[model samples]
Target: MAESLGSNEVTFRLSRCRQSVPRSRAALHAVLGGWGVDQDVLESAELMLSELVTNALRVRVPNDRQVGVRIARLLEDGLLRLEVSDAGSGRPEVRAPGDDETGGRGLLLVEALAHRWGVEKRAGGIGKTVWAELKAPDIVAEPVGREVAAVMVRPGQQVRAWGKWRAVRTVRTESYAAGGLAIVLGLGEGPALRVHAAEPLTVRDDSVPSARERGEGTPG
Candidate 1:
């Protein structure tokens, strides 16, 4: 059984070794398995993650510094975003494979499989993070909090706002108003929310291989 952290998401600071690749991958599979991600999306995520981490580890940087891997559920867009950060500033490029080349196509494979991909400088840090996004299969499972499960915000049902689950002041569902469904709640203080995968509701909150776990495996 994996250790549970109150929050969802994991960030593992990998050592300068190949093992980090698999470690990160396994962590993804474990977390996604618990969240009930689609098998196909999970597989693709594993592959893309491996490539990014592999590239990060392959960079000829100091061994003392560590690489970082983050797996996040982009619920707003229904995307699974995998990011690998390394100290090296070199931007990875997809190269065309030579007829006799045995390797050199990691990014190419990433581009082919990922729904979209990009690289960005680490905010408030050195180096950059190479990220890829994969579309998650529509699985309408409910996104739940520690005690309350997510459901359609019906009238009278309390909701999160400013600082507490304030009484759901009101709900609007006019086709001409805000279009579809919209919730009226104050900003801030509310606990983070989730969206159900298979239903029309709002709520809260992947895999590669087998490897040993090391580094700060903070839950993603």
Candidate 2:
């Protein structure tokens, strides 16, 4: 049985390191529902946990040993924490991989999405614990957080602001199709309007047109 920390916190220890990533992620989504974490956070957390736990297993522990994942919600404080620990001694360092390098971007992604992240010295100096945290969405903020809202734009949709921080913004795309475009907000640096893979598109700028336009779209 997994250990429970108060009503909101859950810690699971797995003897089989292989199960650490998937189990921790599922536990987060399953248990932390009412806390109002966004899907992007959840997905990023999953990938982060996978990388962290995998590093602990492959780099630190012997093949036979295991790792632990702790998921806790500080309800009053509005913080969600994920901790992954293994019985290995060395701490992880973030390295900038070369352009041709294939695999070392895990911690990079974690650093980008997580509001804060760090590693701590475990008791007895035997090993270390890596943790990442995300702040719960402030519902009272000015920008009304909504699910994907799709809008079509004519040629002149003004590009006043173009990023994720804004409550409202504008996006444009090359072609149209039925259910062809979904304006995915809260994506990395900006709101994204995603056209389904099958749609035809023409490119003018170095970057793709923001598929999901958040601002008012004038009729063509």
Candidate 3:
């Protein structure tokens, strides 16, 4: 059973599976609809929820993993926030899309439709939560004229096969970059993926490469 944390937030604690995703997605749609979100925004919100929830379930550890999604509104700014989280160490990456790929296109749609999107470490550093924000169309006193551009990203795969007599063939290709770079790497492989930068990405007295890029640190 799921718990309601008040403040208009609904939490569903369920396993990662094909069946659970649609149900969760539907629930989000209903809840957002009740909030008077327009049809277009409602569809986009549903897509974002579906993609994130699906990712959480797909990449979670196989040992009875529990995934959760939270939807709430910012009372101050009247913005809706959508969060999908899992109790796994895997992070999320964003990248450009490649041709000849199936699936992994959901996140690209989310990034395009959402007003702003980012990832942050879950409370207590046990997991990560990917979130997105959308402006309430009904209540826009002073609209920002700036539009965020969406990137095309998808997922590809490597195929290995044996042909005719006995020769073996292999092909390596991108699986997905939906939403940007949707690949996350943990600290388990040799020469762990790291990005070095000569300058800081921001003026906050820091000198680390941006985290949204591929094969960087954990999301957040």
Candidate 4:
């Protein structure tokens, strides 16, 4: 079961089992999606949450002990915090796994992806909590017509490509005599896609204003 700690916080107690990891991630996705968190940030948060929960499950705890998962959205700071607690002793540490080694890299991934992360002794005095924070931007999907300027496209934004929404990783501009300017977006997956400045592309606008909107000239 999950508990609503406050308007912006929810906590879940999961059994010390492997399935709990995915369950915790689903709960996180539901809560954050309801809050209209940006998709990119939500995805990152989910991955970090999974890693933390997995680490908690690995702790040498009694069978009756359950893993504690807490997710809080700090709107004032535009951050999403994920915490995993368990009634176990040792703290998690990041490690560099060798080429032949297949495991022990979970914390390393968390360290690289999270904006910041740390471990603290649990308030109960018997366990520890590993937590991570990610910069989360509130975003709403808006239908953008084909007339959107090519210069307006930016990385970290999502575009409707190949019949589905894909995150834009890179944006490039090419000028041609016939097309004037074309926007080539390097998506998070698959191949790059090219769209004309006036082509229809659905985009989700982020809370942060784009450079052009902020009076800074379009990025080259």
Candidate 5:
């Protein structure tokens, strides 16, 4: 089961097994993706999350004690935080493994990819939580103010259809005879709509400029 800790945070528990690694990664992707996280930062966060969950599974914890995972987006700091808690003793450290070794490089990769990372003792001292933070890019808000061709509509934007504005969930292109092309917009709550390249569609616009567009750097 998953729980929403806050508007910007989510927490979930996973069984202490290999499958939890991918499950945690997917969960992070969904959360971050929904938050409009940049593609590069999203991928890095997924990798770090996978490593953390895998390490948590390695610890000798009771079978009934599931691993805890928490993901949060720090808006003030523009950072993505990933935490994996296991009910086992000992802190994990970066290791320099020989090239011939099959494993033992998880923390090493985490250190290289993450902006910063460390281990923390869980509340009540039952186990430790491995945490990492990465510099997250500013979310790209959907553009507005002008109607564009149907082919120009991108996923995550809202389009007018069926007497109401619906969120565009996906965009696909289809080719027809004599090199004719059509754009297919899949709505979040209804059937897909097809339109020509020159069809005009309204989308939600960004009323405020983003930090990057304003020449501001990401927060530390």
Candidate 6:
């Protein structure tokens, strides 16, 4: 079970298995939910933590040792600090992942999501700690604008943009600044657009695209 260490800190001791990722996310959901965190920030934090904890659990640890997950909510600073520690020796870093890579693309995701992040040695000299900070008051994505710039749209799908429904020409994840997915709309003829995926939109029957967009993060 997760425990609240104080007014703004929470910690969880995770088992040595793949299930720990979602389990830890549930723990964070519970703690952050109670603290009135913004829905967007909460979800982004969960995604980032999923990546960090998954990275932490990947490295080999000592016999019977488990990963350590800690969260510190700096409300005054408007930042939520998260740390994942393991007894492994390797450190986490960001690098361009190959197109055929199946996994191990988490560092890139972290660089795109968190406000800032880095690695440091643990206190007991056993292993290193990978940490990230997420800013609060996350942008609540609302339907506040139509005719968004052709570049700030999802690719490979039809969207209500550019003053009409258009199919996205080409799309790729992690192609935008700040870690959201990017797609080239106007059937690959126009400039790239910035986009974040929001809730599943309810489009009328005639408005739906043949192939809808999908990804780990969001579309514009």
Measure candidate 3: CA RMSD.
Answer: 24.0
Q: Candidate 3 lDDT, tens digit per residue, 1-220?
A: 5466763566777676678788887787766654555555667778788888887887747747777788886646867788888777766766456777776676787788789998888876578888988875342221112211111111121111121011112212223434222222122122222212221111111112222222333345
Output the better candidate (2/3) by lDDT: 2
Model 6 / residue 6 / CA error / Å:
1.2
Q: Backbone clashes in each candidate structure, one number apiece?
A: 22, 3, 14, 3, 2, 11
List model 6 lDDT by residue over 92-168, tens digit each.
77878788978878989988999999998986758888999998742221222244433444444455545444456
Model 6 bad stretches (over 4 Å): 138-220
Q: What is the C-alpha local distance difference test score of each model?
A: 0.66, 0.58, 0.57, 0.79, 0.81, 0.69
Per-residue alpha-carbon lDDT of model 4 for 1-220, expressed as tens digits? 8898766889989998788988998899888765667667778888889988888888887889998899987877867889988899877789999999978989999999988999999986589999999876453223343435556888987776776566889999888777588889999889998878667666775334423345443346
The CA lDDT at 142 in model 4 is 31
| Pairs that clash in candidate 5 | 143-205, 144-205
Q: Give the 10-residue window scoring lowest on summed lDDT in candidate 4.
A: 139-148
Off by over 4 Å in 4: 139-220
How well does candidate 6 score on lDDT at residue 148?
48
Model 2 worst lDDT run, 10 consecutive residues = 203-212
Candidate 5 lDDT over 47-129, as tens digits, reads 88988898889888779898999988787787888989989998787899998999998999999999999998997659999
Indicate the residue-level lDDT of 69 in model 2: 77
- Candidate 5 overall Cα lDDT vs. reference? 0.81
Model 1 CA lDDT for position 71? 73
Put down candidate 2 lDDT per residue, 53-86, tens digits, no spaces.
Answer: 7777666467665677787765455566788887
TM-score to native of every candidate shown: 0.62, 0.56, 0.58, 0.63, 0.67, 0.61
User: Model 4 lDDT vs. the true structure?
Assistant: 0.79
lDDT of 1 by residue, 108-158 (tens): 999999999999998668999999998874422333433343345544444
